[model samples]
Target: MKRLLILAALLPFTALAAPLNVDNNPNQPGYEIPSQQRMQSRMLNQQQQNKGMLNQQLKVQTQQQQQHLQNQMNNNQQRIQQTQPGMLNTPSTKPVAPRNGDMLKQY
Candidate 1:
């Protein structure tokens, strides 16, 4: 009867010990499962970094295009002013004289 009692007490311990051995097997080859929340957070961080870089590139491109257009507009305005300075300042109302001696009278 004493042996039976001792065996009964040790049976529960053996059952618990078996699971511990299986849990602690470091050399067992298997897929490492990352927790779902950790994977989601990592993916979100990567996406945000990509978006930030893209936004910075776009901003720089837009600034460069605007500067180019402004320079072109300034150069065109300068050329126009040099070509016709009086045209911009005064409106002429005189009728131009004909080169030939024939005059057409407008009554």
Candidate 2:
């Protein structure tokens, strides 16, 4: 019983005397030593900034692609409109002349 009491007192003293080494060197690469809350906040900020830039780039690229496709479609439509009359107005009822007498006989 006495040894148990002594050990219990020593245990509390050991707990109180424990050292807390919490210093982190900022100059070290890939050394993540921040508190949980600070680390989360920093990660969220970085993610937001990256997402913002990515969204901006995606928007610009989408707009450029849409404009390019629209221009191509307009050009194709204009060309089709310009060529439609020529195709539709050509005479299609004429019989083709045979190149040889044998072909004419077969027809």
Best by lDDT: 1
| Per-candidate clash tally | 0, 0
lDDT of 2 by residue, 1-107 (tens): 99999999899777765543223555657557568769899999999999999999999999999999999999999888977987665567888776766464554
| Worst 10-residue lDDT window, candidate 1 | 23-32
Candidate 1 displacement at residue 28 in angstroms: 27
lDDT for position 17 in model 1: 94
Q: Which segments of candidate 2 are over 4 A away from where they belong?
A: 1-34, 88-94, 104-107
For each candidate in turn, the TM-score is 0.48, 0.52
In candidate 2, list every pair of residues with a backbone clash.
none
